[model samples]
Target: MESKRVLITGAAGFLGSHLCDLFIKKGYEVVGMDNLITGDLSNIAHLFKLKNFEFYNHDVSKFVHISGKLDYILHFASPASPIDYLKIPIQTLKVGSLGIHNLLGLAKSKNARILIASTSEVYGDPSVNPQPESYWGNVNPVGPRGVYDEAKRFQEAITMAYHTFHGLETRIVRIFNTYGPRMRLNDGRVLPAFIGQALRGEDLTIFGDGSQTRSFCYVEDLIEGIYKLLLSDYAFPVNIGNPDEITIGQFAEEIIELTGTDQKVVYKDLPQDDPKQRRPDILKAKELLNWEPKITRAEGLKLTYEYFKSLTKEQLEKIDHKDFSEFTR
Candidate 1:
């Protein structure tokens, strides 16, 4: 009997690699693909020896080629971090537009159920607290962060188009701030950035006076929700995240306690269009998917800090970053 096959884009990334492990555990033959533009190979390198897992070093914004049957497709290829997206804004837009189109075409060709990884950035700086899936969003299409924000907005728009126009099988999960192992320490995300500074014996830099709030979901909790959403019949975007929200200043303090760091938070000017508050309203997710995050913040933070602690001195000292100036044109 042939096993079911799943295709995962951005398989080398923190989230996508974790999805690969979950699907493989569920008896699927996993086909992993990444451009490595923002994903790290080390995240998925452990699966190289598995007979059922295969990988391709191909960028999805270009032509995507895959052989054989594919039952599912998870499109997660994009410069997700602010640093990466801001550095290569063009690529970020391309992946959300061109990359998604390519994967949707492939899904149609293979008759596979497709899931697109959307983000809370689609909400931009929301007027509502705990944003619901129905909100139209308040976004600055011309802001510095617009490249990534508008790209994701377009991704969701087009994805819904495919669902309504072509009647394609699809799922969308608008993930919130997720933290766990395999996350790059220098990605400029709040968790890793704070932890990196502490580990480097520097003050924890908090942009925007550290009052802006964000809700975080553990990677495993997010993966579980996504997996269930993929198998379910829901077609619209679903919000999957921990509802336990905290202010950046408060979170920095938590990290200090967790890592046993003596450093304190330092404020800086917030970047343009940075969301002042973001926490997903998961009621729809609750009623529809029968899912909610089970991991407590304390437990999750302890686990994440341990993972950061496990890195070598060099890896901890500096994280991988790319020079995309040559390709941005």
Candidate 2:
């Protein structure tokens, strides 16, 4: 059988790089594209030596032009981190709206199936407990995080439009909080925040009593779920995340244990519009993809700690003091 040609946007990112690695291992020809906006090339630098892997330093928001018979296009572009999207708010919106449009066009031209990396943020400060796909989100349009949340919402709308109007093969996966090795330490997300602080012997900052709950999916599990969705016949959006829930304070404690740090926990003002509770109802993923996260939080956190510990002193410092101001538009 001929090898499938796969194109992945944001190919150098935490999740994107992992997807690229998986595709290459599956005997597929992989093409990766990124602008180095929030994604670091170092994440996938090793893949350049692979015969079936290719990298392109291009931003998808402008225009995407690719050759060869493309079988699949995974649009995982856009700045996902709070610190990132806040810094490049315009780019975040552009990538979700225009970038997705461009990729859908390419998918139509190449007759390739397209999968978009949407987010659980679509359920902005969600009122639902375990959010189901049927729940219409309650997002703030003019809030600080609106740029990213609304962009993802718009991306999903446009994807479905292309699927129905143009008859293009499209898949949307609403990814929840995902963490693993290669995640940018300065991304301002909770997992890295806790881990970085603990590693550096800094006080772990908890916002709003650290009562907010979240479900974290390991990168490997997330990648597998995405792969299954792309190949599956389901058209509607499916949630892909570990249903295991943890409070922010508990998560901080876990990091402290892993890092063996004696640093104390510090309470800080919660960011505006922070969700009180966020977890996915993965019944669809379980029934359709026959997938559940195999790696428990303990196991996943240990693996992540090993990766973070391997970084140089300078790299460790970079993760210690991350600036989140840039994440806003």
Write down the lDDT that model 1 would get.
Answer: 0.91
Q: Residue-wise lDDT of candidate 1 within 1-329, one digit each (tens)?
A: 78999999999998999999999899899999998877778888899999999999999999897999999999999988999988888899999999999999999999899999999999999999989999989999999889999999999889999899999999999999999998888788999888888888799999998889999999999999999999999999999999899999999999888888799678889988899999999999999989999999999989988888888887654454555656667
- lDDT tens string, model 2, 304-327? 889998999987665444453544
- The global C-alpha lDDT for each of the candidates, from Candidate 1 onward, is 0.91, 0.89
- Once superposed on the true structure, which residue ranges of model 1 sit more than 4 Å away at CA? 317-320
Per-candidate TM-score against the hidden true structure: 0.97, 0.96
Worst-scoring 10-residue span by lDDT in model 1: 316-325
**Each candidate: how many clashes?**
0, 6
Residue 14, model 1, lDDT: 88
